[model samples]
Target chain A: MIAENYSLTGKQILHFETFGFLVRRNVFSAEEVAKINGEFDRRRASILAEIDPEEKRTFTQWPTRNPENPFTASLLDDPRIYVPSEQLVGEDSIPIQSHCNSYGKSSGWHVDTFDRRLCVIKNILYLQPTTADRGALRVIPGSHRSPLSEDLRNMDLYGFHDDTSPFLNASGMRGEDIPCYIFESEPGDVITFNELTWHAAFGGYKDRRSLSYNFFTNPKADDEIESMKKIVEHTPANTQGLGTVGLEYHPNWLENADNNPRRARWINWLEKWGFTDVLNN
Target chain B: MSMLTEQQITFFNTFGFIILRKVFSDEELAIMDDEFETSLKTIQGERPDNEVPKHFNWSNLGPETPFLSLLPEDPRICETAEQLFGEHVIAVSSNSNRRVGNTHWHTDQSHPHSYGLKFAAYLQPLNSDNGAFRVIPGSHKQPFNDKLKHIEMHSSEITVPYYSCDSAPGDIVIFNFATWHSSFGGSTNRRMCTIDFYKNPETPEEVEGTYDQVIVDEKVYAKLRAYGSGFHPHWLANPQNSPRRQRWIDWLRKYGFVKSEEA
Candidate 1:
């Protein structure tokens, strides 16, 4: 069992530093897991209400900071998640995106665009048991670090238009044939990985639920600041025209975390990025 | 005298691996078989289990077996290594394996420098139905290989066509360590062995990679502890030495991999 403070062990850090990903089994208590699932479903029903349950659908970047769903918002500051993020990126890091996916078919293999100047990571919390056959998160170990990782960034497999390319079809290789770690997860298990890591999902069910929080280092360098600008403007709907989430935090959710210094830092970071109008206030 | 043909080398470069037909003669095969059987006896005597161990390697067979030890020096092997790598190629490791079940598709290691390769010889005649080797062509190349990781992860769910190497006992299959390869439909008693070699490091990065591979990595050390002694004492004493072999051995000793009788 992880300690109460839940600092990463040296071996865990080594694995992450080498492999670009790590899994913490049973990071949440059973009750917390249930509450998290309840919060996700509660919010999911409100947003995807018009869509038929039978029809396949995917909606990303859902706001988890609803006052009624405090569990989801508190997850951002949870020691189990925050400690590792601090260790990976920097202590001054801020959570950038929170997204929940309901169901989707096989997603293509890709990385979430990496910046050479910054370290970005994604923390995934599955709401249900998932296996390799059922759209489990698959990652290539050490694919984010060096030689091969750069190759992945420049590959033209999917092509400019995301059209099917000859590289994939010529050999009859599918999304699953790629060598990677099949992260079969149960609810409450947390899988944290570098944003640059190559990953994909295949054969997902309709009700398969999971939440993701993307975090990046606080911008210091000029290139890093520019990269951060592009990230905030292009990703979240607040600063950017096309993307997910209008506000980084909900007013009710911010009320609960008003005194917390981490939350203050997060808000300050957002404001510095010209996202002042996005505050829930 | 028996070196890889131009076509064979092209095939290897294009497909990331190749199978040379009957690289070893029948007499050599018999000697290899004997040496292998004797090694199996020694290993079993050490660790007896009813069910075969999932996977275990017997390293440094050259020290234990007379003929097997000389395999790296064989004209066919030496010439091929020279052509592919350079005059400074070094044979680093030799080992036999008792394999079980499926080895999922994976590159051996992501090397920072030049490629390291494994020359494999299967003891039994095998086809795709019974533990034959398989590989994806061009998957070892930079951008092309990057996409293979995702495909390999989902191989069970997706039908990714791969080259199945159906072979007999005398054939030699050589492949880059970065190439994605796996054995499927293997029996509980599947037997195979490999002699690993690498091009001499010329650059600082390559030198560091060489050091990391032999001295720094724990996994590499495990294999070394089992099979990585300096050249066999007999070979050292009665050197049927070639300039090439001696240079390579000298390099290994220089790197502190080889232990002398004095030490």
Candidate 2:
């Protein structure tokens, strides 16, 4: 559980603004992290049993806001998560995406999106101890800003579009060897970054557990709304029969939203933006 | 001939640093290493037992070491500096150091308009966990450069993330003077040397800034004082008598960094 008086400091807010990322340690207690780990394992086991008898190197499914994982869903209401999210992205920011990942292989460097108008931040929780050589997230500080962001976009260092060639522009080094800040973390720590920041992971075990929560600043501008529409349209539905299959949000998540004022507001925003259309079709 | 390619220059401009692998051959490195050791011993004397780990340095491009004094005129070093800072760049100073563990994060030059570069040659193998140079890429530019000032203030711990420039004996790491950089987890007596160069001042403001820098910058002032007369007599005498060295000497004398009558 979060401490009663816990809140992000002004210095931390400035750090996030300056560096494009922030790390808060022990945001969740040991007991809370243990509960999260247990919930993650249960979800993973269910997915594995039904499909993919041979385990894949990575498995990602949305575990938040689901009726089966009410404890995890309530994280949206928890001040430890929402308070900082509000501070960074404004109080009206809404949840855009959630993922619980079981990663086995190294991830190459890439930003989540190049759409500047989207304005999203991701808060990630590792369910295990992570170090530089053990699957920690690495980020290029201030790479989220323009020109550098545009430059990295042009480099296509990770070969996101062309799987045939990778690390083409990595200055003769492997992805892991690229100079970056490795977010070495413990289970209770939360690492947050702008979605446009360049990030990667390397040297991880076969079952490195991570939970990610993405929040987007509520659209007020025309361009922002348009960007939101594009995001909603382009986001592929999770069809792996794991969590929220063939839908942008799970049905139980919407059902649970009615009771929570903050969740309801977020759900209302999603509905207004046509996020529910993916389920309708 | 220019030692740096267009792509390498671009990398330096974009990332605030670049490592040129094997810039010096093994034989060349052996000579440099020998000179560095001899000069350190000659100037600072033998290290005492249980000496407190600290960064030790003395003037490098001076008459005390004839071979090292001429390094500024070496085509590989000179041409690279020219490529980065233009043909008229000023050779600021050079130093050989026995560095201790964890030099904290900072820019050698913090002024927004400051245009200078440092070429560091570490004579020993180093990695992230062993005193390798680390930098936050692109931090030499505005906004990013200013944003990194916090690291300078809170430098005791490696709070911010950085890219480690793990290097070998013959490698050279060239970086912008404003780039935020540090080394961590190093042992005492990590052998290294550096040459600093600045872009030639064109405008009146730049000239005044350069003069002010010479007077106000602690490192530059310290270096000048350490050289006794601001330059070695042999170095001032232009022993090799190269026109390039003559030009630098003339610039130094004109700027009042050296006495005109000393030579």
Candidate 3:
């Protein structure tokens, strides 16, 4: 159902970047998809190795457990997703957040901070069926173009955290704060939204089991894996998963959110390119 | 070469601008900088402020010549200009500002038409701390008919992210005539050389206006006139004396660009 309406224009593909969210008509094959699911187990093993014995139990929710993930290697081989993203984002757009997870698991609705100035064009492949009642993806569509917020409630759907918050500041993100596009999907569906999109995930159908994750445009063809590893190490590790990749620090725990200017820049870029609009709409 | 590729050319047509890097090489830049610096001395007395050290401007500098001669005879620049303007194009005014100052958002037609460059070719490196030329990319194609509102350093309402050439020295950036842009010289010092590159009026109607007055496409013309003088600043009564301005009427008369005005 998600694949029926999304299409990209030449100019839009070339320059119209929405909060770094981009859609690829098709990103994987049944076989390739299966392989990705296979990689999930491999990655889980790695995560297990990395996790401390005491925290290993907590790592069960980690996104890497799905090896047959379309969100990772499958899209790289599929040019449909990679080409447009490559064109819109500089040649440097690459897979930074490559893993698979379900709606109930995807954490946080804040903006991404990899290239703080980069409007995140995420290509997410839905390996499983999705439905709104099951808590599919939620987004603040059109909020990409909204002006930077002066207050958190005024900051659109992502909620506000004034300067005092340890992890995020409400006054940070720039552009419209409109709320729209909480995606409910069907299997084989792919979705992309702006970087500034205000979204959160919740309990979906107990049966909703799918693979999903984000990758960016890497024009330089630089090692996307290397960059993510570095980003993970360099940034304050205590941030929420998305914030850990750089937008806001662990907003769940910290009082003051990281209102870094770079974060705002990413938000602005999302709106400029039109990712805030629901692709089907 | 103009860093803008073919796809970029099309994107600029729609978005208004594109930012790229390293148009000029280090070797070529040294020569160009020295030539630009040397020309600055010739106009030294022409500028009133001796202390305004980094402030250099195009119309003031002279050898009574087009600044193009100063650029190293390189094929890359020529190739770039050819892609944008086509075969033989003239060199427009070359303005080099010495101080860290900003120009309000405006257009080029405000001044008497420029010489060699129709599109402005800019070069500089900018981060938030330093000033970078800001532009409203497609605003050139369509005017903001909405009320003219004062904007902060960055405003999405009236302006948008342009293809800014935020680069270090030796990098050459180019944008077309229809593009809207502004300069910055805030707390940071901005040393930049801006030269306009225009498509020859003799070539043809660039495109029909989107509605508007005059010969250009009505849509674009309306947008152009919408900015009214916003795009072009007003010239004082004493045209020959204003150091900041070019002697347009006089220059037009010399070049026979003007037949006569409706007095």
* Model 3 per-residue lDDT tens digits across residues B1-263: 46355544543444345444566677766655676566556556554773344343443223333243333123544445556665545333334545556666665443223213232334445643356655553443422301112223253222223323345665555666544566655443455555544444441232111001122322333342211211111121332354213333344333333223410
| By lDDT: ranked, best first | 2, 1, 3
Q: Residue-wise lDDT of candidate 1 within B71-122, one digit each (tens)?
A: 8777778778777777778887667777778887888755647568889999
C-alpha lDDT of all candidate models, in order: 0.70, 0.76, 0.41
| Top candidate, metric lDDT | 2
Highest TM-score model number: 2
Retained true contacts (fraction), each candidate: 0.00, 0.37, 0.00
State the displacement of the C-alpha of residue B218, model 3, in Å, after optimal TM-score superposition: 24
| Superposed model 1: Cα runs more than 4 Å off | A1-3, A51-56, A155-166, A236-248, A256-258, A276-281, B1-115, B121-190, B197-263
> Per-residue lDDT for A267 in model 2?
79
> Which has the better lDDT: candidate 1, or candidate 3?
1
Q: A1-281, model 2: which lDDT tens digit per residue?
A: 55675566777777787778988888887988989888888877776777645876354555465666667767877888888888889889987767677876777778887889867899999999999889899898888896667666655565432232244443455666556788988999999999989888877678788878889988889999888777776664433333443244678878763588888888788788776665435
Q: Please write out the lDDT profile of model 1 over residues A1-281, one tens digit for every residue.
A: 34587788765665576567888888887889898888877776665554444444453445565565677877887788889888888888878666665655555677776566778899998888878788788776666755556544444344211236334454345666554677888888898999877787777766677888878898899999888777656543442432343355666655654588887777677767755444332
Q: Cα RMSD (Å) per model? A: 9.8, 3.7, 20.3
Report the TM-score of chain B alone for all candidates: 0.87, 0.89, 0.57
lDDT of 3 at B191: 51
TM-score of each: 0.62, 0.87, 0.37
